[model samples]
Target: MFNDDEKPMAPASNAGRPAVGFSDAGKASVKAEHSKEAPLAASTISVLLDVSSSSSTVGRAPLDLVVVLDVSGSMRGPRLEQLKSAMQFVIKKLSPMDRLSIVTFSNKSDRPCALRAMSEAAKSDLKGIIDGLVARGGTNIEAGLETGLHVLADRQFTESRTANVLVMSDGEQNHGDARQVANPHGVPVYSLAFGADADMKLLSDLATNGGTFNPVPDSGNTGMLAVFSQLMAGLLTVIVQDLHLILSKPTSPDDDLDKIIKVAPGDFNQETDAQSGTVTVKFGDLFSGEVRKVVVDLLLVQATGSDYEADMLEVAVSYPDSKGVRQKFRGQTLHITRSGAATSVRATPNLVAENARRQHAQSIGAARELADGDDLEQARDKLVEAQNALEDVLDQANPLVAILRTELQQLLDRMESPELYKAEGKAYALAAELSHARQRFASRGDVEGVRLFATPRMDAYLKQAKEFAENPDAPVPNADEDAEEEAKANPIALVAGSLAFYIRTAVEALQAIEKIVTATAAAGNA
Candidate 1:
């Protein structure tokens, strides 16, 4: 799980570098053990491709948004009010260039308003429509989605604009086929599962088609607003769209592109042309400061008595800028050398640590599933296995190891305390879900905010920690002398402060790693 204090990678100070970068586990140099009689040798190479946006401010694209609200019987009081507040917040953030549509569903779907530009008059009219919303009947998610799609499709496309649907629901879909409703239509459907009863699987399926799924926990109206605001931030800052990576076939006759693994932006659709020996991967939209990473594996076979340099693979990237202008990056080559030398260089520590983190995430996910099934012991064992694996590759000198170790220990503690685990099980589950989401799609900064909102208690502690850090001389609260004494004995304050310290340390370590990588790359070029 990501800590509250762990900040995302800051933009590189240098501006000449491309936003996207490619690296590997190590230089693809393999020492061959072939003798006079040996005919062939085999080895595998791993490549990591990272795509990031520069920190510079860019023009904002106009948005065509469809707000789908579920006014079901379950959402009668505070839930309905919170939903209304969230919608209004979104409205305030939109500019005149953006167009908005409102769709409400409860056994049936109703489009209260069509796509209208965010003029003062339009905002007033939408607020009136939102204020009149009432909760009743069943949940017709299909109707909500279909109506949203209709609104979006009806709009005429303008230059440099993006469109999508935001579905906010607090219950299970009682009618209609949500899957059929979410067919490919160029526009993605971002779904928010409001409250515990919201059908996560249904919303996940809807968003998986082309968008993201967020679970809005029942943590009152404030939490609702936070989640909505975070989503809006992502929508408003999209810097690149329709990003595609094409991997051409290797030039070496003896080598083959074995596999392509998407290590980040969790759920992406990829297609391959068997005849052309080419692979195409589609990454939807990238917000500024977001990074998308992927790894490709290649298998190389060398004929006997041959020492040669082989072009392992070529990667070409294409995407549209915020202005809808197409930009292409002509492919770069990854070379591998087969040598008779006695030694081969080891993989870089950063690459090794990244791979370990990926594996750890997978392990944590598997353990969560087992725990959900009431197999706590097995879950602990799985996590223990993961911890051991991480320890094998991570040395004491690496600061990340300590951070990771602390996270694992905290999770293990949760599992061991039955009372604590039962009380905070949902929060724990959500933390895992959010962690996986960040690993797959959300930007690092986005994940930090979302995770804080989703876990109320943690958020409170983190906030308190920040306050304390900013004003160390401020007096601690106390109701009376006894209360003041109790406050002094309280572990919560200490834990919160410690968490803040750890988070700062972890973030600094990550920044140091980035600097090291930059320096190493420059040295290699020199």
Candidate 2:
């Protein structure tokens, strides 16, 4: 426990590099909670590390994005057309500050469009190039990735700019090993498996650098566009990069330090230092209004002090600001109140943290493996068990619980029937469950499934995209138009503003009628 005179450490700053004001007042906040705050004796303490970014985060960084496309013979007719349409949507969505590069692969690769700012003329040229792309030859995914990674690596500006690669393919690679292609710059390479024939495992392996391998079943232009929109939503609103969380025991005079038993970092990579007994988990980048939860199990020793609180762990979060300067949030202490009586303390669990653990269980690849192995019974049973565990902690009426229930039920449905399991069922189940656990938004298993968990911005853009797809002649809505529509949808404040005026006018009319009646009566009496 911290002494009365002790204060939380201030945010650390680099000495030379200038700190740019990027996010809002609170860039990010970290809080740790225990399932059982007060325990009678030594027990496993479930520590939930809740990390969130500010909703009002400002200073959007410029983007350097590369779209690596596969123009193999397999993607001939509708597949090629859908790919072009998706590329056009991506180009339209980017702002002038953002740069886009295109790479097409068929046995080999070609960079038709280099990294250039998204000006009106540039966008037009890119769209034309996309339309002119012809599908032929075999797939060389390695060459495409190599070209894309090189294009992104050779950037003119580094400060206050974000870079990423998007690889779209629908066929197996007949060329070099894609996994061997090094991502030295650590730019996130998101993969879009276009159709059923696409190798999801290869794509998944390639996306180890802070990216997701999203499976897009052969649905249509809308399906392709939906996935793109979801990816862009996070990429465009990047608030922090190279984020890391360090967990360690609090300092004390006695040799009684808490032990970090285990950690479930969920899709992110983690490293533990043997000498220092500190664990660091790399979260890569965080988007505005995004949440990343890390669960840790600790063995806490009894505190040897007169204070009533026992400090168990200290959590410190660090990330690079837009200017490439390292900024650190003050370390926070998770304390449990010390109790004397054995029966006095009640073990109350933190439902949010507990539910997150349950969600993580579903995403750990067990269900995916079982489903892939054709063990439908075991897979369904695994999902049911996780769902039941979630229900045990949370009520069915809770929105969080409902989301888990819906997800589990959908997976169960897929497992019971062979037809559904084969037709994008397994893909959907894995992607949905993983997205939930990782807190990354993705398309639903059913191609036409409604957007369940997209950011407000992404959801609006998707709605507009669907509207335009329905009728190409209709004018596409802009941000201002979206805001207006939202205001119209909820006009309570507008009505309230005029409510006072209406009441005043009504009262004045009643007073005038009373005066007129009094005047008429007086005149008749006279």
- On lDDT, the candidate that comes out on top is 2
Query: Which residues of candidate 2, in runs, are more than 4 Å off?
Result: 1-25, 251-257, 303-307, 342-364, 416-419, 444-453, 471-526
lDDT tens digits, residue span 1-526, model 1: 1011111121122111111221111101111111112113555555666655422212334567888999999999999888876676667656555678888999999987878867668878998998899999999999888888887665555455677788888888889778787455668777777776777667766765346666665764455565566566556545456667777765545443344433233457778786775777787765434555565655555444646444556666676643456766544445556665523324556657657767776877787788777888898898899889886774557765665665566667767755545443333444445445444332111234324212222233234333433553454221122122323465242133224434544774575466569768979999
The alpha-carbon lDDT assigned to residue 506 of candidate 2 equals 70
Tell me how far the alpha carbon of residue 160 in candidate 2 is from the true structure, in angstroms, after superposition: 2.8
Give the TM-scores of the predictions, in the order they appear.
Answer: 0.68, 0.79
State the displacement of the C-alpha of residue 427, model 1, in Å, after optimal TM-score superposition.
7.9
Best by TM-score: 2
Candidate 2 structure quality by residue, lDDT tens digits, 131-152: 8999999999999999888886
**In model 2, how many backbone clashes occur?**
0
- The per-model lDDT (C-alpha) reads 0.58, 0.67
